[model samples]
Structures are given as C-alpha cells and as structure tokens.
Target: MHDQDRKLLQQMFEAAVHAAEPGAAMRPFLPARPAGRVVVVGAGKGAAQMAAALEELWAGPLEGVVVTRYGFGVATRGIRVLEAAHPVPDAAGVAASEALFAAVEGLGPDDLVIALITGGGSALLAAPVAGLGLADEVALNEVLLSSGAPIGAMNALRRILSRVKGGRLAQAAHPARVVSLIVSDVPGDDPAQVASGPTVPGAGGRAAALAAVEQFGIALPERLGSALEQGEEPPRPDDPGFARDEVHVIASGAKSLEAAGAVARAAGFTPVILSDAIEGEAREVAKVHAAIAREVVLRDRPFARPVAILSGGETTVTLRRTGGRGGRNSAFLLSLALEIEGLDGIAAMAADTDGVDGSEDNAGAFADGTSAARIRAAGVDPAAALARDDAWSAFAAVGDLYVTGPTGTNVNDFRVILIR
Candidate 1:
C-alpha cells in the first residue's frame, strides 16, 4: 500500500539528482573559447561526468584528465578518467592531484583550461602544502575526518596547505583563461569551498583555518601549525590569477529542490519546497522537520494535509558521541523518529543524492510512525543506536534503509517529508 509513496520518494530523489547532472546542466553554461588546445582538468564526484559533458559541447580537440571518487567515473573518450578515494584522500588521489597541476603548467594564452570542480574534489584532488609530505597530510586528514568538523571549516584548513587548491590551480594555468564549471555540494554553494575551489580563489584566510583546527580539536602536525601561522593564505578574486578566469555553478541544491518539488507534484502531491539553504546539525534539522510534520498532521497551519516539505543543503553531524557509524542523513532520520514518536500517516526519507552519508554504505534511512515498533521488534534499542550514531544498522534491521551506490552526480542532499 505504501509502496507508491516509496516509489514516488525514490523518483523525487532521482529527479533532483538527474536535474543537476552535468549531462543535462553543463551545456548552457559552457563558454566559447577561441582557437587553442582545450584541456579539461578537474576533480570531484562529478568530475568524470562533467568532463564528459565538456567533451560533448566543447568545440575543438579536447584532451585532459579528471579525477573522481572510486566507482564514480563516467565513460568519456577525450578526457582520461581516474578514480580516487573521497572524503578521505588515497594514493590515487594524491597522484592525480599532482598530475593535474603539472599538466596545466606552461600552457600558452591561447590554451584554455576547463576545470570541472564539484563536490568531493577536496580529497580527490589533494596536494599537500609545501614542506609537508603526503604522509603528514594523510595523518592530519584522519584527525579532521573523525573530528566531525564542518566541510567548509575542514576545507579551509586544506586550502592553506595546498599548492593546487584554493586559487592555486588557476594560478598554475597563468596566462591561459581558466573556466570552472562547478557542481556545488557545500552549504551556500560557495565556489571557493566546492571541491576546495581548485580553479577558484577561495575566501578563506590562514586565521580561519587556525580557528577551525582549534574549534574541532584536531591534532595538527608541526608543519601544519607553522604553515598556518606563516602562510599568507590562498588568493581571492583580487588576486591576479583570477583576473582572466570565470566560474559557473552548473548545479546547486536549490535547483535540485525545485526538481524534487516538481516530481512530487507530478505524483499528485502538492509539493512545497521549503528552502534549499537549510543548514544545521543533521539530527537538529530532523527535529525541525519533525515539528513541521506534526503541524501538518494535526493543525495543517502552514500547509494543508498531505504537505511534502522539501529542502536541500548540506548538514553536519558532530560526533561528540563515541562509536557513531551512521551518516548525517541516517542520523537526521533517526532523530526525526525520536521527536515525532509515532505520528500517524506521516513518513519521510532523507538521503544524499551522491549515494553516501558520512562513511556509511547507505544513502540514508526511512522513518514513519511504525519506526518505534520496528526498532523494538528488531531488538535494537533506538535510543542506544542513536547514541552510537549507528542509525544505518537500526534502519537496516527494520528494512527501511536506502542504498543507491555512487549516483555519478552530486547536487548536495535531498529530503522529503510526506503527510497524507
């Protein structure tokens, strides 16, 4: 009986992601370039697909390299695709990051560098700051990852210590006009933080990184501390490297939200897109969602019955709790269940369109009035699991887990709250 809603939910999520795909979204933003060799260099979950899009629309002989998360690569002819680890840097990521910077070096003014920047580029395009070895970067990255720091704060630190991140990649392509087509995954869609702004001069200064490190309580290496203290920080728009460059956000959370709303409407529910810029801790956001769901179920004040609250944006999951294993979406759904208890005829699904939440294998989880009973039947205490941040296991036991592997596109996250 509820399978219709579940299918609709899946369609909405898939529609949102599909709307943001480089294949559909990249063509209109493409820039016309004069006669020269077009080198497509990029890194992110969408890098390979974005590269393919550029290859298709791009006039002239196109050749380049783009790095994406492992298993996220799209088939492309002109541009070489390399797979690398994401959210955490791996050896392949390190090698590709180096090769990309080196590839664009010494290109003439006639040469064009099309940098396809997107979410997950930070780790996929890693380049250690000068005087810091890759090992040093890796160790510090492990600390930062587990610290539960926000992506912006984490990337701010990474920006300072990289020769390729921030505005450095654009710097490397000096005299050659660089155009960055970004698929935003960060809150606010700041091009600087999206994929660590490889071709864009970022907005973060050294002081900001220092503050992030201290805020997150991440143990830093000696070189990182020294670099943070001494480094002038990356360039911004004022820098000369940015003088002849441009950036186009081919996809964003807002666009994806609208796409989801359209899908819900097509499925016979009046979709209300709350906002695309929703932000907060994952579980806290879930509480807000719960409140809205309750209002619709009881009073239906802000919206009528059968309101489907839709939103998009990245949320953080601070793991002050120990041994947490679930992603932010899972945590959000788990928390939503707790707040609403078991409201009748209300259901919700939250998932990252990119097919990952935290380090978990599941996209996210599903929750409704029956969630409490399901948890009890599974012999898994919801409160205990929530404490451990293992909502992935909790949802799995209840057969409410969502797992869509590497959707080959990233448009931040999509969430649907349905009441009927």
Candidate 2:
C-alpha cells in the first residue's frame, strides 16, 4: 500500500508538470503568421522547447535564437537554440541575449517577434547593462536567492540592471509587432513579473527595485546603485514601444494544480487544492502544511481519509549556512520530515516542475513514515542535515530523491501530501 501511494503521488506530480508543457500549451496562443518574416526569441527553462513547438505549428519561414537552461535545450529545424546557465547569469547567456537583440533589431512593422517567456528568463536573458559585469550580476543574484526575496522583487532588480529585460526587448523591436507567450511561475501570474517582463511593460520603476533591495539589506554594487539613482527605468506601460505589443499567459501554476487534482480524482482519492499561490520561507511553509496534515489526520474536519492535499507555487529559502546542498523544495521536504515525525499512513513529495531545484540535479525529494527510519538506520542525522541545508545527501541516503531530467517546463514548485 505504501508503494502504491508513492506511485500515485508521483503520477500526480507528473500530471501537473505535463499540463504546463510548452508543446501542449503554446499552440493555441500562437499568433497569426505575419506577412513578413517571423523572428522568434525567448529565454527560460522551456524556451528551446517552446521555440520547437512554434516551429512545428507555423508553416512559414522562421529564423531566431532562443536561450534555455543548459540541459533544457531541444532541437529545432529553423530556430537556433542556445544553452546557458539558469538561476544565475553566465557568459553564454549574456552572449545569447545579445544575439537575440541583434536578431530583432531594425525590424519593420510587417515583421513579427514571437517571444517565449517563462520562469527562468530572468537568468537566461543575462545581458547586463553597461558598467555591470556578468560577475556582478551573478553575485547580486546569489545574494537575492540566499536572501529569500520573492520572485517579484528579484525580477524587479533584474529588470533594472539588464539591457534586455523590462520591456527593453520589446523596445528594441521598435515597429515590429511583439507577441509574448508566457508560462507563469510567479504568484498572481503577473505578465510584468514573468521573466522580468522582457517584452511586457513593468508596473513599477527603480524606486520599487531599490526598496526591495534595501528591505532585504542587500548591498548593491556602486555602479548598480548609481544606475538606480539615475532612474533610467524600464519602459512604462504607456510607452509607445509596447503600443502594438501583446502578452498572453499560455500556462500557469493554477492550471497545473488543477491538472494534479484531476489525477487524484481518477485514482479514487479526494483531492483538496489548498492554494496555487503559496509562498514563504520553505521551512515555514512546510510547518504550515504539517499543521494542516495533522488536522486531517487527527480531526478530519476539513478532509477525511484517503485524501490528497495539493498546492503549487514558488517558495523561497533563506540560507543560514554556507556550502549547503539543496534547493527550496528539498529544504521544504526535509523540514516536513522532521515536522511529521514519522506519522503512519501519510506521505508527501515536493518538487519543482522544471526538474531542477536550486543548483542541484534532482527535481526535489519525498518523505514518508519510513523516511526518518531509513535515515536513522543508515546512521545519518536528519536534524543536522536540515540545519546545514544538506537535504540532498539526507534524502539521497534514503533513496527518496526525486529526479526527472529536464521536463521542458517551469511552473515553479508542486507539492502534494497524501493521507490514508
């Protein structure tokens, strides 16, 4: 029965991820083929797959360059796909973003720019503004990630310090009609926040970015601070460059969670979707989930036995120790393992939809009644692992680390807890 429950939970996760696949969700949102050339450009975990899907659907000549995370690249006939680092900027990403800028430059009104935007675009489109090196951008990103800043705040800083983000790419296309098809991973599915709104106008300016940085007590480089002071912001919503630009949300976390819920129903389980926009410190969020799971087990007031509690959203993790080896999802699972304390007939899994969590290779990890027992029998200390942020090793020792190589989509994190 435990093995069967694990299989069911894994199936639910796979269903959630498949619902956000670029090839499936991108087709209906495709723009009409323009009379002139079609130029495609984008950045994210799924950009290459999205480009491939567009090429498969369109019957016209399309030429463009798209940047994706290193392992997420897909082969396309016409559009060139480039691999780059994600969650942090790299030289390869910077070069690819510049190439994309050149690809859409000096386009006329007849030409159309199809931008495939997704969760990781902020890092994939790493064209830094003048006076900021890739190292500087990378350092800032490291601080932001470790500081536990929300995606919106981090993306705001990304836009201010970038040459291609915050509607600057749309501004570069000038007279061309820019159509941005987005896969949202952030809460609220704000078009302006997805991928730092490379083609969509941002809602705020340098002031907001500065406040976010200061709120987190992050020290900005001298040049970055100066740039923020200078207040050369991204294109406003009323900017003429976005006059003809259009943005469409092809898929989102909510849609993915709903798909997961459907899978649970088919498997003869009552699935309760808690929320699709959950966000907070990962361990704190795990405790909240633990509390709810306890309620279902102890009182069964909100939900009864044979139920699955599902949620989807991006959660932040503030690192207290250096040289830790886990992402937010793993951290959440680790904390959850400690919280539940080996409760019987309950199992849970937390994973990123993109098949990569933080800097690790595995998507995430899972915990069940026997998870702690397995770790203890192997002579590993789970509490110490959680304290040092070494969840990868802890879960790996128990063979509970969930790994799915490059799912070609990014809808942020998906979590489900099963009670029986």
Candidate 3:
C-alpha cells in the first residue's frame, strides 16, 4: 500500500509539472508578429526553455539573449541562452543582465520586445543599482532567505535594489511595444511579483521596500539600507513609459494544482483542492495540514476516506542557522511525518515544480505513516534533523528524497496528501 501510494503521488506531481511546460503554456499567450524587429529577453529557471519555445512558435525573424540557472539551459537557435546562479546573484548574472539591457537598446516604436519572465529571475537577472555591487546583492539575498520573509516582501525589497527589475527593463526599451509572458510562481498569481517584475511595474515604491525590511526584521548593511532609503523608485504602473507595454500570466500555481487534481481523480480518489496561494513557515503549514488530515481520517467530517488533498504555492523556511540542508518542501514533509507518526492510511508528497528545492539537488521528499519509524530505525533523530534544518539528511537516510534534475519550468511548490 505504501508503494502504491507513492506511485500515485509521483504521477500527480509529474502531471502538475507537465501542465506548466514552457512550450505548451506559452503558445496561447504569444503576441502577433511585430512590424519591426522582435528582440527576446528574459531570466528565470525556465527562461532558456521559454526562449526555445518562442523560437519554434514565432514565424518572424527574432534574436536576443536569456539567462537561466546553470543546469536549466536548453538548445536554442535564434535566442542565445546563458547560464547563471540562482537564489543568489553572481558575476555571471551581472554580465547576462547587462547583455539583456543591451538587447532592447535603440529600438524604434515599431519594434517589439517579447519578455519571457518567470520565477527565479530575481536572482538570475542580477543587475545592482549604482550604489550597490554584486557582493551587496549576494548578501541581501542571503539575509532575505534566512529572514523568513514571504516571497512578495522579499521581491519588493529586490525590486528597489535592482537596476533591471520593477519595470526598469521595459523602461529601457521605451517607445518600443513590450509584451511580457510570465510563468508565475508567487502567491496570488501576480505577474508583477514574479521575478520581481522585470517587465512589469511594482505596486509600491521604495517605502514599501523599506517596510518589508522592517517587517521581516532583516538586518541590512548600513550602506545597503541607506541606498534603499534614498534610491530612485522604479517605474510605476502609471508611468507613461509603460503605456505601450502588455503583460500576460501564461502559467501559474493554480493551473498546476488543477492538473494534479485531475490525476488524483483519475486514480480513483476524490480530489480536494485546498488552495494555491498558501504561504507562511513550512513547518507551521505542515502542522495545519496534519490537523486537517487527522480530522478527515478519524471523523471523516470535512472529507471522507479515499481522498487526495492537494495544494500549490511557495512556502518559505526561516533558517534557524546558516548551513541548513533542505528546502521548504523537504522541511514541510519532515514536520508532517512527525505530526502523523504511526497514523494509518495517510501518505503525502511535497516538491517544487522546478525540480530543485532550495539549493539542494532534491525536489522534495515523501512521507507516510511509517516514515517516522523508518527514519528512527535508520539511526537518525528526526527531531534533531528538523531543529537543525537538515530534513534532507533524514529523508536521505530513509531513501525518500525526490530528485528530478531541472524540469525547465517553475510554477512553485506542489503538495498532496492522500488518505484512505
């Protein structure tokens, strides 16, 4: 039964990923061929794949450059694909960002700029404002990741610090018509929040960015803080420079959750889609999920037996220490295992749709009623692992770490629990 449940969960995860594939999801959102040149530019885990898809879809002559994470690049003819670091900015990302800025320079009003923005672009397209350097940006990301702030708040801060974010990319191509196709990984499916809105404007100004820093209790370097206080605000939605710009969210976490629900239904389980915009600390969220599962199993109140509960959205992990091993998905699964220890007929899987959770190689991990026992028997303390933010090691000891290299798309986290 454990093996069968694992197989079913894996099938649903794959279905979710397939629904967000760059080629198919972007097909319906492609703009009409432009009268002048079509210059492509974008950054994300799926940027390279998006570029490859665009190259095959559009019939006109188009050429440009896109930056993606190191292993996420794909073969492309007209659009040059560049690789860079993710979740943190690096020198390579800086160079790629400069190239992206150069791609849209000197374009006429007749020219069209197709921007393929997706999740992870905040780190992939790393162009610091004048007062900040790449090191400053790297430090900013490290602090933000450990601060336990939500992605929206983190991105709001990033938009203020970056030269190429928050509609600055669109501003660089002023007078040219810019169309942005986004694969949203943020909650609420806001295109402006995805990748910190390289082509779309942010809702708030520098005040919002500072508010995020204060709200998250993030300690910024004195110089970085001053820069945030005094830096020029990025272009807003009302800016005339963006009058000709158009934005479309081509794919999102909601769509992925729906795909997973269909797979669950086909496998003879009544699917319940909880929500696609869930956020907060991963462990806390797991506790709530466990409580819901317990209610369904013991009383069958809200949902009867033989039901699959599915959800999507990016959950954050506030690192207790510096050298944590797993991403939010793994941490959530580990926490869930602890809550449902020895409970019968409950199995769950949590994973990132991009095929990489946090900085580790595994997308996530699997857990069942026996997970806690198996983990304990492997000579590792489950509680200790969770306390140290080392959920990957616990899952590894039980051979439950889910590893799929570079799925070429990023819709966000996919989580499902099955009870019978």
Candidate 4:
C-alpha cells in the first residue's frame, strides 16, 4: 500500500516538473531567425534540451555553448552543449564557463544573443570575481548553505561576489541584442535573482550583499569579507552594462503545480493547488500544512477528504546543528510526520523538482501519519534528527527518502499533501 502511495506521489511530482520543462515553455518566446549573428549561451539542467528545441525550430546558423549537469547532454547538431557540475562548481565547470564567455566575444549590436537560464546555473557559471578563487566561492557557499538562509539570501551573496553572475554575463555581451529566456526557480520569478541573475541586471551593491550574508548569520572567508567590503561589487542596474537586455520568465511554479494537479485528478484523486510561491522555513511550513490537513480530516474545511494539496516554492532550513543529511523537503516531511503523530489516513510528499534537495542525491521524502512512530520503534528519534537538520538520516532509518538521480530539468520544488 505504501509503495502504491509512493508511486502516485512520485508521478504527481514528475508531472509537475515536466510541465515546466524548458522545451514546453520556451517555444513561444523564441525570436525569429536573426538577420545577423545568432549566438546561444545557456546554463542549467535543461540547457541541452532547450538548445535542441531551439535548434529544431530555427533554421539559421544557431551556434553557442550551454552547460548542463553531468550525463544530461543531448545531441544538438549546431550548438555545443557541455556537461558541467551543479550545486558545486568543479574545474571542468570553471573551464567551460571561461569558454562560454569567450564564445560570445566580438559580437556586434546587429547580433542576437539567446541566453537560456534556469535553476542550478549559478553554480554552473563558476567564474569567480577577480581575487576571489574557486576555493573562496566554495567556502562562501558552504557557509550560506549551513546558515539556513533562504534562496534569495544565498543568491544575493552570490550576485555580489561573482564576476559572471548577476548580469555580468549579459553585460559582457554588450552591444549585442541580448534576450534571456529563463525557466524560473526562485520565488516571484525575480529575473535578477534567478540563477544568480547572470543575464538580468541585479540589485544591491557589495555592501548590500555583505549585509545580507551577515543578516543571515552566514560567515565569509577573511579575504572575501575584505574584498566585499573594499572592492566594487558586481555590475548593478546603475552600471552602463544595463544598456539593452530583455528577460522573459518562460516557466514558473504555478504552471508546474497546475500540471501536477491535472495528473492528480487523472489519477482519481481530487486536486487542490494551495499555492505556487509558498515560502518560509521548512519545518514551520510543514506545521501549518499539518494544521490545514487536520482540519480537512475533522471538519472538511477548504478541502474534503480524498484530496491532494499541492504547492511549489523554495523553502529554507536553518541549520542549528551539524551532521544533518537532508534537503528542505525531507526536513519538511520529517517535521510534518512528527507534528501529525497518531493522525490517521493522511499522506504527504515534498521534493525538489530538480531531483536533488539541499545537496542530497534524493529528490525529497514521503511520509504518512505513522512515519514518526515507525522511526521511533526502529530506535530513531525523529525530533532529535530534525533538530539537528538530519532529516535524511531519520527518513533513511526507515527507508522513506526518495532518490531520483537527475530529472534533467529544474523549477525549484514540488510538494503534495494528500488526505484520505
């Protein structure tokens, strides 16, 4: 029975992700064959696929390089799609990023530059600011990840310190007509924050970025701290680099949720889409969801039994203790499990649609009312695990963590709560 539930939950989440795939969302926004040079530079899990889609549609000499996660490369006749590391930058990614900047060099104002941006692109674009080595950026990333900062906070810091992020890339291709087609992963689809806003002109300065890091209690390397405080930050909107740019959010959480809701309905369960932009700490978000579910079970308010509550958005996890091995979704699931202890006939799933959550290979976690009790009987304390931000251990203790190698596309996260 649990297997069937798990399968259903996975199907729902998969459908949600597919709905926001770049191919599905990018077709309409593609410009006509440019009269001059047409260069496509993109980064994300979906870049290769998006490139193929664009190549198929345009008959001109479409040439460029796009970096995707390892094993995600697809054959495209014209565009060179390079595979790179995601969530973490590697030497290969750094080299490819350097090559990408070189690829679009020397283009004129008559040229058309198509930039495909999506989730995970921030790390994929590994060109750190001058004087800031790869190790420095990695150290900063580590601090922000453990700080429990929201996606916006993490990205704010990234935009300030990186050379190629936060509109710097677009600025590099200055004089060229730059059009960015983005598959949004951040809440509100703020073009400036998506994938560290490589193409969109960014907000805030070096001081603002440093302030965000400090506000979130994130530590920075000594050198990085001094650089951010002394050196000029990344190109902001005030810079002359903001000359000509157009950014269009091709896919978003709402579209993904609607697609998942359709799948749920097709699977014989009533679907209730809560919101696509839900934001907060993972555990607190889970508690509120549990409260609503309890009402549905007892009072049938807002939604009746046999309905699935769907939501999409990025959630944060403030890590207080170390040794936790889970993403926000699993943390949310474990927290929900503890809150709904002893409650009967309810199920939930929370996962990053990208198929990796909080640096874990697993997509997310799933649990019903008995999830907490089952772990306790197995000599695991879900509360202790959660308090340590070690949700993966707690769920793994009972074989509840959901692992999907790579979905090849990303739109942040998808969560489903079913009451039956």
Candidate that scores best on lDDT: 3
Give the clashing residue pairs of candidate 1, or none.
none
State which candidate has the highest TM-score.
3
Clashing pairs in 4: none
Worst 10 residues of 1 by lDDT: 315-324
Candidate 3 Cα outliers beyond 4 Å, as residue runs: none
Give each prediction's root-mean-square deviation over alpha carbons: 1.8, 1.3, 0.9, 2.1
**Tens-place lDDT digits, model 4, residues 38-146:** 9999998778888888887777788899998887788899899888776668877788788789978998878889998878888788887778888886777677766
State in Å the error of residue 39, model 1.
0.5
Which is the winner by TM-score between candidate 1 and candidate 3? Answer: 3
Task: Candidate 4: list runs displaced more than 4 Å.
Answer: 1-4, 238-243, 267-270
Cα lDDT tens digits, model 1, 1-420, are 178778888888888888888877888878787577788898888788788877777767887899998888878987999998877787898899878977797898888888888888877876887777777667767777667677778878878888788888888887899988888887788888887788887676888898888887867868778877876668876887577788888889888888888888876778998777677788888888888888888898689976678987877776666776788888888888887776887778999988887777788878887886788689988878887878888888888988998777787778898888
Estimated TM-score per prediction?
0.95, 0.97, 0.99, 0.93
Candidate 3 residues 3-113, lDDT tens each? 889899999999999999988998988888878999999999999999998988888888999999998988999899999998888999999999999999999999999
